[model samples]
Target: MEEEKILAIDYLATTPVTAKDKRLKARRDPWMSRVLRYTLEGWPTTVDNELLPYWRRHEELSVREVCVLWCDRVIIPRVERPAIIAELHFGHPGMTKMKAVARSYLWWPGMDKNLEGTVRACERCQQRVKAPPRALLHPQLLPKRLWSRIHVDYAGSFMGRMFLVTVDAFSKWLDVYATQSATTEVTSEKRKTSFAIHGIPERLVSDNGTCFTSSEFRTFCESQGIIHTKSTPYHPSSNRLAERAVQTFKDGSRKLETRSLNETLQTFC
Candidate 1:
């Protein structure tokens, strides 16, 4: 019989505890025990809800000596997850970067949420959150009153979140929303939120992004009694207020220190 080769996760090379310590901890872990047994023997027909996450991915799981692995990534034990999270977050790399690095090396149940929570709870990480590169600020046609004419644009994936940036042309008051999507639905929803506070604008200006040009968005604007205008195709600068609003958001976010992305955006304004 050919020997089964073991895979190594580069991130585990610098584990807080040694491999022997990890093996010892793994031996004491009930979840790891089940995973090890299932991989070495055969997966059971069914599992309780707590273990269902593991059962779903059993086919990709393997063992290296006594350590549990999900494909090439280490399945970190529950006891060591805090230390592991600390090590992963050592440099105060924000939630997004930490998650990306963790995916390359190790995993745990709720790892994504865990990583996000860690950074949110960490003061150093929150203080050092950076924004996208600064862009040139352009002047645009001013309007007569606040909320009469507004410029809108998308900014991100900045600090692991997309943002809908709205700038009132008359007042230059900024509103930023941390969003998971840049879809037409999300865009309109954000606009509605702004409208609830400041009332709907008479004219809305944006670049030629599909989120703005889509029929769905056009209908949304028409329904709201808004005059929607798009910048010349391939000439985003024509919608100078929104373009500069995005730049202002990026520039403002860099100097911000807040508990969450949404708070950072709110505080910047």
Candidate 2:
């Protein structure tokens, strides 16, 4: 009997793995693993157990290979099987439906319990969809006088393009100048010309982008009798007015599907 069992195992081992072999495929499937683990103990083991014979036959297959075969043959064939599984006498339908969705994607062997744990951990489903954005700590009251506090910044360049932005705090008046480069040499010259046309403002707020923080920009501000201030790192709201104006221009430009920032700035102005 033992020699016969060994011969059977050897014969099964020589068989090529294929989808047509359901008995071979089930041994590798995680869902089937769970089912077998729960119920196989109740069945008497023969001289050569069914699982041992199958494993001997497919000893060359890796776990991942087994999973792929199982998915392709078993899981994909019954695409909505989890939903039907949900119908098989269980808990809340809502809970069951979620499990159904999760199982549809996450149902590899050993994942059934982990998927349930993940479903339990979702806070969004536990509560409402959204909470109102926290109240703004600093409401932006527009400066009462034009040019009393100005915001200036550079946008777009380093790939050989540039646009300079200046906005009057009160009127929200915006001026955009296209520059050939973002270097101090080009930016300082452009600032001089812009301020010459619009007159120097009391304060300039900007981010710490290299174009704004350059030594040339500081010297230009000093020469123009303008006070230069910078926003906190990554915190654009420190230069709120100028920041909002820039966003408005970019968003409108994108919505209009235009190539020219000049045209977008013109619309905003």
Query: Which 10 consecutive residues of model 1 have the lowest summed lDDT?
Result: 1-10
**Per-residue lDDT over 76-146 for candidate 2, one digit per residue giving the tens place of the 0 to 100 score:** 21233343333321221224554554354333333355445544554532332243433342435556677
The estimated TM-scores of all candidates read 0.47, 0.43
- What ranges in model 2 sit over 4 Å off? 1-142, 157-160, 233-237, 258-262
Judge candidate 2 against the unseen true structure and give its global Cα lDDT, from 0 to 1.
0.52
lDDT of 1 by residue, 1-269 (tens): 01222223344325465568877888788887778888899988998787888898899988776766777777888988988887777545577778888887787889998998898887767765654444544455557677998889899878888889888888878888889989999999988988998898999989878899999999999999999878785764367777777876775576454446765654545
Ten-residue stretch with the least lDDT total in model 2: 68-77
Global CA lDDT of candidate 1, please? 0.77
